[model samples]
Structure formats: C-alpha cells, structure tokens
Target: MENELLGKFKLVVGMEIHFHLKTEKKMFCSCCADIWEKEPNTVVCPVCLGLPGALPVPNIDAVKKTQMMGLALDCSLNMKSRFDRKHYFYPDLPKGYQISQYKQPLCIDGKLKLESGTVVDIERVHLEEDVAKSFHEEGKTLVDFNKSGIPLVEIVTRPCFRNIPDTVEYCKQIQLMVKYLGIGEADMEKGQMRLEVNISLRTSEQERKDELPKYKVEVKNINSFKFVEKAIQSEIIRQRELLENGITPMQENRGFKEGSMKTVPQRSKEEAKDYRYFPEPDIPPMEFTPEYIKDLKTNLPPTPYMIIDKLEKEIGLSRNNAKTMVEKLGPSYISKFEKLLRMGADPIQTSNLLLNKKEYRNVSEEEIIEVIKNTKTAYSKMEENELNAVIKKVLANNLKAVEDFKKGKESSVMYLVGEAMRMTSGKNKPDPIQLKQKILDMLDSDAN
Candidate 1:
C-alpha cells in the first residue's frame, strides 16, 4: 500500500555506523584484538574487565585508522581530540560508562556520494571503545567481555537521506571502503560492524526544507543491510499512522525484532545530557601535528571507486560485473588479477572463475594461468574437421536452437556451443568464443 502521508510529510534519516578497527590490541588495554574465535570472557584483561585500579591507554594505531577513514570521506581531521566517558548501565557494559568522544571528535564535515548521485553529509567521525557481547537465551541474559574494549570508529551522518535505496547504497559503499582501506573487514554477520538509524517525519509541507521534526525514532544494533531497509520502512509506516491520528510519535530507541520486519521500542532515547559525558581521567588527550596527519593521508590506499573504475575501463568488465568482482575478491587481490592479465589470461574468463568457481578464488596466479593454458590446449587439440563434425552434430540435435539463431536470436548460438561441448570429451571441446564463430560460419554456409 502507498504511504498514507507520502506527499503530506517528508522523511528525514541519518545513520550512526560503528565498526571495529582491525587493530592488534584492545583500545584501552594490551589484550589481543583477535578474539573472534576465542572462548567467551577468556580474552578479558583487567582494563577491559573494568577491574579496580586498572587504567586505560589509547591505541595509537586505532586512532590513525579512524583518521584514515575520515580522510577517505573528505573530512577535516582535528589535531586535538580526546575520549570522554559516556555513562550508561547495561549487562553488556562491564564499565558503568563507555569511553567515547563527545565534543572533540577526530574528524568532521565529510560527505559520501551514493551511486545515484545524492550526497549524504557526515557530521562527525569519532573514536570509542566497544561494549561486550550480549546473548539472550530463554528468559535470561548472558554477557561476554571478550568484545569489550575493542576499538570502534563511529561515523555520524546528517539527516540527509530521503529514501531507503540511497541509504542502503551508502552503507554498502562504506563496507567496501573499509575493506579497501584494510582498516576492518566490516563483516556484519561476524559483529565487526553495526548500524543504527535515526529517522523522523516532518508533519507539515510548510516546514522549512532544513527543519527537523519535533521527535525522532532511533532503531539500534541492526546487523544486516536488508534489516536496515526493512526497519526503516516499517518505522516510517508506524510513525505515519501515529501522526495521521493527530498523535506525535515518541522519541525512543527501538530494535528490529528477530525473524520479523517490525520494530519494537527499546527505551526512551537519551539525550547527550543523560550520558553525563566527561573527559577520561586515565588516558591523556591525543594530539598530532599537521605533518603527521599529512603523512598518513599521503600513504592511504586507493578507494573502492578507483578500483571499480579500473576494472571497468581498463579491464573491459561491465559496471555491474566490475562491482561484483571488487566486492567478492576485495581490493587486496587486485595484484593477483593483474598478474593473470599479464600472463595473457582473458579478463572476462578470469572474473567468471573468481566469482563462480569457488576453488579458483584461492588458487595461485600460476595455477590460474595453467588452467587457462590447458583450456586453450584442449581446444587446439581438436582438429578443425573433427570440431566441424561435432558442431554439425550439435546443430542436428538442437534444430530449434539453430532455427532461433538463424532468426536472429544470437543468444541461441551459446546453447548450441554447450551442446557441442557436451558431444566431445575432455580434450576435444573448443573454447566457447572460438566454437561460436565456427558454428556461425557453418550455419552461413548451409544458408548459402
């Protein structure tokens, strides 16, 4: 059903995305950061466990990585930034408060342009420590401190999104960008990243374009992009219904219910004042020189946009195919792809093997070349006379496909080529493109 208030109200959305940094140690302690495979609570240390007399220390590498992402997003980096204590009480939080940035965020004023050409404005990119993992079973709640103190970077965007598609695309681009930067894997399934949506609807068409609604609803801890899209749509409907009845929606934190498309209220959304933010006393404020920031920016890797462009323009892959290759193979594997190209491998064939052939994805450059060579050698071994005979037999077997090809359905030629391949053994089948041309030539001869 169409939104009852589509034209009467405007949708304003912003997002707060938190992702773990691929640092070697915890943000405030020296505990190992690779706790994904470890037993719950086993990786905990005094600082991460919030034990008495333990002080927190900042991870310099995590700081740099956060700034690196800021630079990629065209944000201004602050030479002076500090961690503040955000007080809250939850089972997942070992510390009564989380160390986060409130006032002096590391990066600010960035924008990311979506594929549809709509630009989303980023308010600030800040650094913070993540909370522990919480699992609910039956009527009880369990907490694991293994995830506690893990370095997290939060990207806050302005209320710029007006639709769901652009919002989803922005999240996808952010994922790809993080991988390209080698900062984080951003695997949502593995808890490396999480998404929160801040959404509201303006009640009046007469409201200024830039004016926000009196109330907003926050949907928290959404793990999947599909869930994000669904949650946003469901919340829009829920809020619209309330407004339609002359009732204002409450400002609150909500969660997408598991196995369903609906959102349920979690709590009343807390403003900054409720957090009781204060600077961390244990860790000193971080300060960097312009020269240091400049050096880090200079050494940054290529963005996902650059990789996709190269794959499409230089390697002759379609735009959609190029994006798929980048997403599946990642930017780190670009070197291996270039090596295959240097060894005279076809771009389209290599892309297909990498994407569809699971085993080929991890094979070395030499193995890929050998496979391509063997395919070529097999096609060459089939004598022209024998190949022509095989093609004729395929045409006879699939007369309808041949007829379609004759009637200008060029796609039918591929069907006949597959038939020809099946009619021969391991070393007798020709390369698909080469076989197609020969089949076309034979069909032309019969027509003449």
Candidate 2:
C-alpha cells in the first residue's frame, strides 16, 4: 500500500453537473417553473410545448443567477452571449431540439477548491433547458412535459481530479455553493441536480500528454456523491483490468448499480455531431455592460471553501468543526459566529454553544451575541451543587454503569458525564476533564 497504491496510475476525471435554477418561470416561456408542484402538462405552454409560431421569451432572472454563480466561482463573465439549438429527437423533447449555450456561453475560465487542497478547473458554466420527466411503467415509457422547459445551469469541470476523494469533495463544494446562493436546493435525490462523470486512467504523465485517452466512460445521472465515488473507483478497477488483458475500453455510457456498487454499461456514447447543434433562432444574443458584471461580483456571497478555510486557519478551529459550522450554520452563518467571537466569546466554546444547541437554530446575529454575552455573566461554569445533582441523576439512571466503573471499567464515568450532559439538554455541558474526575470521586465515595 505504498503511496496508497495511487502512485502507479493517475485518476483523471471531468464532471458535468446540471443544476436546476430557481427562477419562477420556465427558461423560454411563462409557464410555471416549479417542476415538482403541478400536475403533468399543467405547467406547459405554447412556447414550451413547441407549438408552431409560439416563440420563446427568456427569463431574465435565470441569466442573472448564472452570472452570480460565475462570480462565486471566480469565472470570467462574458459581455456577449447567445443560445444555440441542439438537435435531437425524443418523445420528451416536443421541439426535437434543445436550446442551450454552445459557442458563446455566459461564463468561462473558473476554478473550485476541494477540501483536500486540490483545485479543479472549470471549463464553463452555461445555460440550458431541462428535459421532461420520463417514467417507465408496465413496460411502457411515459413523458411529462411539465418539467421540459425549466432553466438549468450546466457546470463543466476540467479533467483535473486525481483521486476519488477529491472528486467527491469538489462535487460537494459546488453543491454547497449553489445552495448558499439560493439558486436551488441542489438535492440530487429530488432530481434537482444531476452529475455526469468522465473517467480515465493513465500510467504515466508523458503518455497522457501524448494522447490522454480519447475513449472515456461516462457515468450519468449519479444521484449522490457517495455513489459517484463508488462508481469512479469501480470504473478505474475495470479499466485497469481491461488494460492488463490487452483490451481497449470503449467509450460508452455506464450506470452505477446500487446493490453491487458496480458500473453497468448503458449505451454507446454520442459524439458532438450526433446532436446536430445550431444557433437557437428563438432567442437573441445577449450583451452585458461592465457595470453589470461588477455589481454581480460585489453582491456575490463568500464561497463555502473560503468560509471553512477561514474558520480553520484564522480562528484555530479543527477542519471538522469548520466544516460543521458551514454545514449547520450555512455559508453565511460563519460570519455571525465570527461577530460573537469579536464581542468577547471564546472561539471553541462559542462554536460548541451555538452549534450544539437544539433550541438556538437560525437565530439572528444580535440574538446570538446577546445570548453569548448573557451566558458569560450568568454562569462561568456549572454550579458545583447543580453539577453534583446532574451527575447523581445520571448515575441513578444507569446503575449497571456505576458498578462497572467500580469494577475497574474507568471509561464508564465519562459515559455517565455524557448522560448528564444529555439530561441537561446540552445547555450546561461541562468540560469532560472536570466532569470525569468528579464522577470518579462519586463512584469512590459510594464504594467506601
């Protein structure tokens, strides 16, 4: 297991992440963009339904949100952009073509940081329309056009991932960013987000540079990040085995099977020409002023990566603690905690109080600060009498654990301290060091 067995080969991955936008209307029509709420065909309109002479009118909010996402990623927002029609025929696509940004996208040249410290380069973040919902029942396929015209942002990442962990971390960071921006929930299970991963392996950097394998396996519609990692790892092993047997892995689409944690072949991959892409006639090219881009960058929220990094590096918090702060409190929630620290709250203790409380969720900055200030003045620590009563109650509940402590199971006292903390609803949780010593003394007193 030298070098984690990854030294022999490089794991190259590129990802295309589709995130549904939170716009109120469909991308090209005035139909309800809330894809999950209405009945089938109720959200459809003439424009979205692709009826003859029913022209499209783009939703301006969707464009602005994409620009916001670009600024968050440090992407270059183009002053000029336009949409194109990607020709394809399917039962769900009433128009037989998809209107998406092809040549002139709204954003370009970006990067996202993983928790592992590796940076994944962004190829583009382009606007596109979503396809309809497809259902297979009774061996027949059914289509729902209600979801057909929803706005979507396709985030394309470079083939920069070298490990399975980095890929998953990168995906999570993006998901957190989207949720923080209030664009959408980015819930993969609800089909609000979809992932397509491009994976290939090379034995040497030189060989990769010469011709970084054109053939790649694409795992599409991965509903979860854990499954994304599992699928990539299994595909890597499959490719290595294929190479060892002197067979070339064909470029194709694969699926992750939940039961086996293995990838199954889906279909032969489509080339760019297969779609017959052309400029979208129903929409006009777009142009933005320098002032617009500046305003967008100014209004963008701090990315999750920066928040976690600051919490860890500047405040001396553990990586897990920082991540928890962002996860529970949200990307913007860390700043409120920082404000409390500035008003004379210990970082570690303040984080524990705010983060571990059941009754103090989503509180305002002023309220949190007031609560912290009051706690500092009211109880320096738990009163000695209250602490004893709490410990006695904990021991009384778990008589077997008390006997176990007397029988040389020293770890049982800490367990009792945990029970006391639980009994107090985590409001007066004491330092474990002091609690453990006190509990041991109580056990010794009972024995004598």
Candidate 3:
C-alpha cells in the first residue's frame, strides 16, 4: 500500500517451494542423509558424485513420500514420470545437470484453501535431487557435497496472490500442511525448505485497460517467510517507482539481502537456452502402478486447514486460537484438552493452563483431576464475583510489584499474578488482569 508510484497497480505473487524429504539416505545413493550437518564431502558416494560406471537408482521411500504429498494436496497423481537433466554450470552441481522432472511431474492440478477462503491453485509437484551447497567467504568459494543428491519435492503454485499478506499466509498455510502430512520437516532455518517468489504488477482495472503490462521480476533464494514478505513489499515499491518515472521494470532475478531488507540484482532472467535442459540419461524413467498410487492416498494425513475447521466447530474454539493450539500442541494433545473441557473444566481456563500457565509443572493429569475434584466442592459454592474479590485482596497486598506494573513495567504483573494465585491456594476465579488492576488501585490509595 505504501507504493504510490505505479498509479494503482495490482501486485501478483507466485511461489516455488522446495522441501527436502526426511529420509535415511540420499535419493539415488546409499549415503546417509545426515550429510547436511556433517563435514563437507564426507557423506558423498560414487553415485551421488556421478562418477564413471556409477548408476542412479531411485529411492522407493522418497517416491512413496512424493506420492503421499500429492494425495494430501488433492493433486492428480501421474502413473509415470521421468527424470530430466537440468543442465547448468555451477560449483555446487556435481552432475552439471540436476536430475529433475520436466514434461511429467509426480503431481499436478492441486488447490490449497487459505484462511480467507481464497484457494491458490498449484501447478505441479515434482521430484528432484538436491545439489551440494556452496559456501563463500573472504576471497574464495568452497563446495560441500554433504547435501548432494538429497531427495527434494518442488511445489509450484499458480500466480494468484494479490498482496503481501496473502502471499505470506499462503506460504505459512502450505508449510503447515506439508508438516501435517508428515512429508517433510519444512524447516527454513535448516535449509530443508526454500522459497522462490515470482512477482509482477498489472495496471488497475480503471487504468490502461486497453494494454497490459509485461514487466515481471523474480526474487530468488528467499529462505524465511519474513524475508519473502519483506522482499515482495520492497520489490512492489521499487517497481512502482520505476513505472511512475515512465520506466518499465525489467525481467530479472534478484536476491534478498536480510540485513538491509532489500532485493539486489542477481542475474538476468534466463530463457530455456540458459538451462539447456535435456533428458537425464543416467537415471531410468520411473513408473508407478494404480495400486501404488492408491496405497499412497490411503496413507495421506488430513490437511491442517481441515483439521482447524473441525476443531473450531466441534470444540467451540476460535479459529485462530484453535489453529495455534493445534499446531503447538499437536493432535493428540488437542484431543486430551478437548476431553478435559468436556469433563466440565472451563475451556478458556483449560486452554490457558495448557498453553500459557506453567503453574502445575511435574503434576500428572491424574493428580490434576484429583485436585479439581476436591476443589470443585468449595469452588462451586461461591459466586464468580465473590471468588474474584478474594483474588483481588490477595493481589492488593503485593504493593511494590503492583506499582511496577502501573509504571509500564508490564512484565512485573506476572509476579503479582503468581503471588495472588499462591495466596488464594489456586482457588480464585478472577482473571489475571482483574487481579493486577486491583493491586494497582490499592497501591494508588496507599500513596494518597
């Protein structure tokens, strides 16, 4: 919204996400997948390095995982998909051309629904082998083949996002979905998941309806979700400025600089000639039968969005809170919490106790049940206001700490709450905030 230069242009965003599979060994080799953290070149084998007389065999587990992921995303599973060579010259690529899918991908024609009820269509989900990582420092660059030949699944989405928030939400939702499906860890910090954003701007409906703009840009190697959001916002502003000055944004690749929160030019956008992609001769075409696809579909987990909606409707939880709780606590924990709520424990209180309050540490659920059973007799006798009054009195006596909270030292309120709970023997029915305010008023009266 800050970008005002392009005379009202609509921002469009698409993402290509690559997630490394959590497997024991490399895609085509027996070498361990632990190479990512190991010393450089130590985990590499002849097959991964594409040495002479070495042949590549597809990893069955990796293939099954890709199929399962496809099923979870509601994608069409291709019975057969062949590996192609994406030829390029880079220090990291040991084979010189990556073994990837071109014409035939593992999955196609999928859609993901966002929280806003918008569905982003997925173009394809393909399988490939990851290349080695290159480390550059000082004056030289070094190649680490430890990560070479790891199994990866690349998901490409259609250009559908209209703003920064939508793009971010889509990425986060997809990441969660991938995690829920048990496909991959999808950890951006560990390089297990990476993102590439393709962005373009079009003139608004009211402006220049006769001709559409052809200016487009690609931001590559955006690792973190925060960086993806920031880079898109920065690029939108940058392109708008250029267009305002009667300049069209050129088609090119840009790198995101985390420190400065800006995008820097990396290289010109390459056409098909740049990659020189061809059929991979070293690997054979992989085929899957109908039974194989059906087996994978049976193993697919429920999508995170679906789970969120069910939890909200069935458990009477807010959508956002349920999503957060389910994500943090996992499905098993959520079920336990729901059971406790059904047994007459207050829902909000139960949520807070499970998530925020750590007061009953080291106590088993059985012990909690026992305590609740004994306390309910005394607790139910008093009205809510009367129970809250006892809590307020306990917090009011903690004068010094209450003063700290009133002076904007808000973190001090925790100490007051803890003390109040202790004084009331955890029997008070008042909310934490009411106790804190009562303590502040007592302090003010004492000062007067």
Per-residue lDDT of model 3, residues 369-428, tens digit only: 554555333234465556557656755676677667655476876787677656564435
The clash count for each model shown is 0, 1, 0
Candidate 1, residue 303: how far the Cα is off, in Å: 1.4
Give the C-alpha miss distance for residue 215 in model 3, angstroms.
3.3
* Residue 189 miss distance in model 2 (angstroms): 2.0
Q: Model 1, 15-40: lDDT tens per residue?
A: 99999999999999999999988999
In candidate 2, where is summed lDDT lowest over 10 consecutive residues? 1-10
Residue 98, candidate 3: Cα error in Å is: 0.5
Q: State the lDDT at 322 in candidate 1.
A: 73
Q: Write the per-residue lDDT of candidate 2 for residues 1-448, one digit (tens) a residue.
A: 2124334666778999999999889998888787786778878878888778989888899999998888888899999999999888888887788889988999999987665568789999999889888889999999888888899999998887777777887788889999888887888877999888999877776455755765789998899998897888788888877866778789999998989999999978999889888888768899999988888887887777777778889997766567767887774556667777887777776776666674665776667667666663333454777888888888899999988876557678778888877776455666664565567657756764
RMSD of each: 7.7, 8.4, 7.5
Error of 2 at 147 (Å): 1.5
lDDT of all predictions: 0.86, 0.81, 0.75
Q: Which candidate is the best by TM-score?
A: 1
lDDT for predicted candidate 2 compared with the true structure: 0.81
Cα deviation at 174, candidate 1, in Å, is: 1.2
